[model samples]
Target: MGTVVDAPAVVTEKEVVAENMLGDKKVTVVFVLGGPGSGKGTQCSNIVEHFGFTHLSAGDLLRAEIKSGSENGTMIENMIKEGKIVPSEVTIKLLQQAMIKNENDKFLIDGFPRNEENRAAFENTKISPAFVLFFNCSEEEMERRLLGRNEGRVDDNIETIRKRFKVFVESSLPVIEYYDAKDKVKKIDAAKPIPEVFEDVKAIFAPYAKAT
Candidate 1:
């Protein structure tokens, strides 16, 4: 018998947007990846203010979906509660919608593509990031920040934070590695204070700042 190979899985409607929609637009995207409590949201806010880029946090969008009582809200809430990743289809849809709705063409997408599947999905959809800003922080420091944040996030509890850390190390770190191998990762030490960290972030973003 001849050898046979399976066909690739069909791309979902969300994946089609991932592959084709953003690429067709004149958009510049920077992916902000980090362990939970690594200050991704904080630095992204600074980037938005200084560089004129829109800040799109995947987590925030999902939370908003939950609050809006979307059909997927219950499933997303459950996944979040378990410290599990939401499906890429759901996340990608939210991201695409946000990008289209916003007026700015430059965006800092924070806390997304949290696993290899996510990375692959985005890549397949044709959404290549300009670069990945990796917030490198020790687990001890991250744990301290999350515990002290007092933001009342359901996932801020120590147990859930630990699970998030584990997921980052196992799932998210590989995405950084993939970008690193391509010389497309800008690694930042997130253990420092906010001002010091943004100082470093500013340097990486200087060119974009000039363009804006």
Candidate 2:
């Protein structure tokens, strides 16, 4: 198992207390939202590697279910291919169970709360992130990257790609707006190269990057 790092002093002083007051809990969750190929996954990896936070990727969880050959595996795989979100209860349950099993205070939850209903469910569960990281990339660039991803997944097709973009515009926009209104959203330009993108992400997380 990897070693856990010490919580940053800034986080301890600023967010920890307030977050504790909100739930009287120790966990610190940073929710990240972005459209397909917006670099959310890459940034999450960097955050976990540098900051020692647990990374909970919703997309990965869904993919795992699809790979499990369970009763819903086929259906889940089809949904993912079409860029449609899985049901909230299913995903929220998965997230809760994962968090319970891990027992980590710091978490970077990637690719979650895709729609308003999904966001509300998380909020209803009394789970709130210290802040949200939103990746803002142009539509053209996003399409370009998604096409290039060529992950041989069902969702890699052009029809589904366009559908995903449309769904993202319609369903995910309000969630971002909500976070923006609360003044807890950090927008990152995800159109740049991976290293440059990570540099910006690193700066956002520098306060928490010290090795414990």
Best by lDDT: 1
Residues 64-152, candidate 1: write the lDDT tens digits: 99998878888899898999768898888889889988877888989888889998887755778989999999999999998998778
Task: Give the whole-model CA lDDT for all candidates, comma-separated.
Answer: 0.86, 0.81
Off by over 4 Å in 2: 1-25, 65-86
Point out where model 1 deviates above 4 Å.
1-24, 72-85, 210-212
Residue by residue across 64-169, what tens digits does model 2's lDDT show? Answer: 8788897677877787789876778878877776777775668888877888999998886666888899999998898898888758888877888889889899
Q: Which candidate is the best by TM-score?
A: 1
TM-score of 2: 0.78
C-alpha lDDT of residue 23 in model 2: 34
How does model 1 fare in lDDT? 0.86
Instruction: Give the distance in Å from residue 123's predicted Cα in candidate 1 to where it truly belongs.
Output: 0.9
- Worst 10-residue stretch by lDDT in candidate 2? 16-25
